[model samples]
Target: MKNQTKMWLLIIISIFSSLIIFIAASFIMGDFGNKGYDIGDLKTISNEVLTTIDQQEKGISSILDAAHAEHPAVHFEWIQADGTAIYNTAGTPQNYDFQQLADHFLSIPYNLWTEGETISLVYKTHLQQQPYYLLMKLPSTAMQPGQVYFFLRTTKVLLTLLLPLIIAFMVPYLLAIWFFSRMNRRIHKLNHALTQVNLQKDIIVLQDTSKDEIGQLTQHYNSMVERIQSQVIEIEQFDNKRKQLLSNLSHDLRTPLTMILGYAETIRNGLYKDDRELQSSAKIILQRSRYMDKLLDQLLDITRQNTHALTLQLAPHNISEMLRKILADYLLFLDGQDYIVDVHIEDTDIMIHIDVALMERAIRNIIDNALRYGKEGHYLGIILKEQQNDVWITIKDKGPGIASAEQERIFERFYRVHQGRQGDGLGIGLSIVQEIVDLHQASIHVTSVPYEETLFQIRLPKKEDELN
Candidate 1:
């Protein structure tokens, strides 16, 4: 639920609960206080007092003694018709004008008379046929009906006025503590998780089951951590690959550089026997220099691709024609290599969007790999065809094919297959091929069987409008 609605609900519940407790306590206390001092008990005592007066054969002295013994908390006074005090249960007898007092008591309203802290009830009884007034005074503090009624009324009024103020002040104060404490705990957990991430350089996911705002914050935090974790893993892998690339480049450059230097030195010092020998040394030096130049170029190309510095210039072109030209160039280069070039180009006008230069590079890398490694098999096959919405190009060679385990790693930078023909080229060609294909939103697959066929297939999505 929304926080505002939840707060309102809490306030309402607290108020009602407080009111219920107040009312229930008032009733319990009232009932407890009125246990033996209720109006009915008072009436019974008054009746007993009159009965003892009537049955007093010993006189007024005996009646007073009996009344005091029966009800110790009550004070009784006996007066004549003229308000002259005849006897008193309290120490000294006072000649109080009881008749005037009785007249004043009768004149006052019943509700107004019951507001006092004491209850004064005047009784008219005949003592030996003479009218006598008995004034019994009961302290309301002893749980008389007047005091209980007054207490209930007054307490109700004060509580009614104060309850809202009490709830207004206490509810927010109490709720502030409770709500903030709960919020603080959640925030503390998030802070702790962040601290752990900072300390360990690792991702920490929090478990938040609530649907509140705090829970949403937790979800966002977890998502951010996941992204950071993924980026961290990618960075570590990139660093390892970079180190590998540097190592491979140094090793590869050293060989060609060493060969070029030795050949150049031999020619420079006049170590050649004749013009033909000198020419051969120069040629060897030139070839090694070209190889080193090509290796450097490849390294730069792969680096550019990896760092997103290379962007594809996509245009619609007939891949079939592109493949034909590429194959023609390769066939010219493989003139006397004693290799069979099996080419099958499907005559379709299907056009696909691609970066011509990058796509050519990717296809050439696969075919070049096949030729370099599959020289012993003396076979190269290239096929281009349209299937459904995609154009598929398959290059197959009958060389010692890659193992299943090595096939997956073959596209990784500088990851060379050590078991087979051991081509002279560094292992970044296929890595560049994969990157180029991915940039075109295309897919590549490789499958090989030793001495049978090693196949590299490229699938490029055809332009939908052109296909239609």
Candidate 2:
């Protein structure tokens, strides 16, 4: 059930429970006070009072006088069977109708009855074994001869005792009701806020100021929304890139295919004048064909990487040795470039698990990029640092460094910082490098200052046993 419903239900039960307890206590105390006088109890008190009065030497008259002196509010008359008043209190009327009072008592359910707006108590007793009736007039029916009755016209006494009882039971009950109501209202407000929130516009927030469990829930929900928003933005960006990629791929492929088709058609039509011209046409066709093949291969590699279908042959190998071997091929290529090479390797040997072939490709791709764009700076440096359980390989070059904004995007498929620069290969070299690095559970990032220097850092984790 809803919290509000449960809270109201609990409050109702508490009030009813308290009321039941109060009524039950009243009944119990009433019985304990002996106010609900049974016939046996009334007979006992009447017998004692009558015996004392009969033993007096002056008879009922002196006894009545003495009782009147002691209790001025008490009034009674001792009536004989013949309706003659043997003894009457001073306040008794001279023509008091005893027959009417006796008849009135017989008609009522209880011995106590009201007479003309006055209330009194009646008891049947015997003086000297002769049957008589003791008729007592009282200020209030509540002030009986031997017991106090709480349920009569005892307003002052009942109010005096009931005021404190009401406060003792009602104060806490009211406070509890207020507390639950306040909580229910706050929760309802929170629920309304949650329902009205629009994630497409902005994150949902609770206006509640208290640092309670609900507040914590709001914080966690906000965090989850933020993560979802970021992922949505990233997916949208990737979608845009994919659209552009298809357009670029078609353009790049069509250029080379058109050239190859034109030259082959010319050769087939024998449009060339001599063998030399024919050979030139054939060589151009072969070069374009090779370029297309290379582009297609890069495309395949990227597709496989994205689909998690790229396989790796994982084995422990010395990372320092791997770097040296990959650089050997680049050293051969840089022979006529007149570039200065600064190579740094820590003396310690570090063994890390990696896919050797893929890692070499990633390294070669980065160095090739450096040599291609950084030729003007004429300085290439390789640094390898072996730490406790990790390896750091940094390649630095003095080149027209990449802009900060383009650093991250350069790793996208077919993305090139300087598209105008002459190049023989597809623009997926860096993208492939990123794919391979990620496959080996490694991280790679680049930082550069324009026209100054660019540093590409790659961190690889080593196995725990190897570190030990």
Tens-digit lDDT track for model 2 on 1-468?
988788878888988997999789977876766353333444554465577776763467777667667656566677766666667786553334766775544534344433333344567766567887776654434333244345646678788888998899889978988987877777776677567655466655555566877667667666666786787787777777677666667777888899999999999999999999999999999999987887788788768767877677788888888888777877887898788999998767767888888888888888878887887899889999977667888998999899888987899876778764333355678888887777777789799975578999998877644323
Backbone clashes in candidate 1 total 0
Off by over 4 Å in 1: 1-176, 347-350, 419-426, 464-468
lDDT of 1 by residue, 3-32 (tens): 556666777787789779988997898686
- Candidate 2 TM-score to native: 0.61
Give the per-residue Cα lDDT of candidate 2 at 464: 40
Q: Which ten residues in a row have the lowest lDDT in candidate 1?
A: 107-116
- In candidate 2, clashing pairs total 0
Per-residue lDDT for 396 in model 1? Answer: 95
Candidate 1, after superposition: displacement of residue 306 in Å? 4.0
